[model samples]
Target: MARGAASERDGSLSDGVRPGEEPADAAPPALAIEGLSKRFGDGAASVLAVDDVGLTVERGSIVGLLGPNGAGKTTLIKCTLGIVLPDSGSVRVFGADVTDGRRAAYANVDAMLEGARNDYWRLTVRENLRYFATIAGVDPDSVRGRHDRLLDRLELTAKADTPVRELSRGMKQKVSLASVLAGGAELVFLDEPTLGLDVESSRTLRRELRRLAREEGLTIVLSSHDMDVVEDVCDRVVMMANGRIVADDTVAALRSGAGDVVRVVSADVDDAVVATLRERFDVRGVETDLGAVERDGDRRDGGDRRGPTAVEVAAGGDALYDLMDALRAAGVTVEGIETVRPELEDVFVDLTGVEPGEGGSDEGGSGEGDLSDAAADSRGRSP
Candidate 1:
């Protein structure tokens, strides 16, 4: 939410308004949540899906919502969208509280959950856009220009007249996204937006999302298991675990906080050598390239099949020196050594104690069936 001094001069703020002063017509943050809590059941069977969470997403920013399965991400989003009412706390969209009037608060909000929306299969891609726009209380004809642009940007213009049911899954996904934006929603929630996209299509979508946020001042809350997309497109990341926010910061800050590890590749490293190194250092993992020694002409005589082994040790600061000294004592000649910075996935694992794709099935107490039902209900109604 911090704005630079240059923002004032660059017309980022209302004219003549000083820094931190809100103009009468100034828009509030795209979304706001305070002390939000949701529980599925009572007594011993109860599960806290969202645990007194508070978050604010600035206009024109992309915030990545990340967590492993059953992390309450889905439940939290459902609560925010009024698909699942919270036990306590409040959700406000565009300065209107949902409790006051969901229709007014979410008038300009739209979401694509689980990688796709429920687009009309019988309608053409263009018709689907117009239909969604109409249901959202916008005149389809009035936003034809925007619809055209969305189709062009998503590379669906050629198939705009094609029936959505006849399109490939990837194309249908694109149409779903197009439908979400056809109404010119100011705030959009996209879950796994790039799920069915190819590499090129995914890149296109990423570029379009950045452009929309930068040029049109669109705000987005993106949830995806694809760390690269989140890191590439999001301004900030909010990570959840056990129905609570564990880390909320920029991707760079998270990675930097996780520190760095040392990768040591040596031709002399065998199981015994790795075991010795493990005793002295934090060995994250080891990969043995069976053909590396033959390829690099480091193969030994006497029918030794051992090849170059690369071991990643979580050795930061002075620990790195100890790792090197131990390797030398083991009579290991280092072939390659470099410090490897932790990625978002690495930091996620460090904080959550599990890989992004592995976790329990429940989001708080609600199962996948509950989430799907909520999503389906949301899609059936116009925000």
Candidate 2:
């Protein structure tokens, strides 16, 4: 078995999912956010970025913070990390009041927010790690030992002597991440750590992040716009849109949202046939979209009636046999069960309607909503 996983090479390994096959019931919370709200500028034109949102992240568990562009995810994260002060809210990192304690509380916390804070352009990757570890008050000698191992694992051993300015974006990202681990932080915060990495590098980073969190018993809070990243990495997910938690549940629980999408891949699927599906399932989701595709429709889209599709309802733990039975009874052709599964992309698109940007910046764009979900899902809320 892989560390923090049900199986080796399981998608869950890189995805950060722990389905708890134990057959037991209930678990403890690791990190909790309570009634957290952060508003920028006050009064009349105050922009409410993180409004009364909360959720819990468990020890030795991976959780994802998801939302669309301008959803105030960054603001909330900033507030949690003490980078931004909240108007009214509280964030607990490893059970510490993050907004109140400041540096002392952050001593046990290590983060690579926006993946940009880890580098020293003049220093080598190894040098950077040494410097950060030293500053974090970790033993100097321990830095050397850990540096070698991190360089090897991150495939940066060859680049140990390379200047940060010379490395590629992905390489820099790896180095930055290594610095976080080097600090020996008990809790890790990574916001889009793999944003620009290539596929292989991204996969390795994901795999390693999973291993680090589980095997080392590190608590992690990860924010990402990639549904695959979130779907694969989180044990549970907390979604924020228009500055609030809209959906909070296990990935398995969220997949239940996609309990309806059925991918057909046997022969040709013509327009008429597609049209036939439209009449039955909410076919509006099938249109060409620039965003990631989920099993049924959008989970992050945040639009009422985002689109309906049999694929989504098909997900919520429903058996494919039942679906085939329904399809056949509906007079729809059964092309061969290519695969019956839920799509996280559909789940994300459904709720926020847009991909989450690095920060709630205007460049990535924001969602359209008159949200009343101002302060939902705070960890304080009773389950």
Q: What is the C-alpha RMSD of each candidate to the true structure, in Å?
A: 5.8, 11.8
Top candidate by TM-score: 1
Candidate 1 stretches with Cα past 4 Å from truth are 1-27, 115-117, 293-304, 363-366, 379-383
Q: Looking at candidate 2, what is the lDDT of residue 220?
A: 81
lDDT of each: 0.80, 0.62
lDDT of 2: 0.62
| TM-score between model 1 and native | 0.87
What would the per-residue lDDT of candidate 2 be over residues 231-319, giving only the tens digit for each residue?
Answer: 77778888777887888888888867655555542122344555655565544333322122243443334254232222222322345
Leading candidate by lDDT: 1
Cα deviation at 181, candidate 1, in Å, is 0.4
Error of 1 at 300 (Å): 9.7
TM-score of each: 0.87, 0.71
Q: At residue 335, what lDDT does model 2 achieve?
A: 32
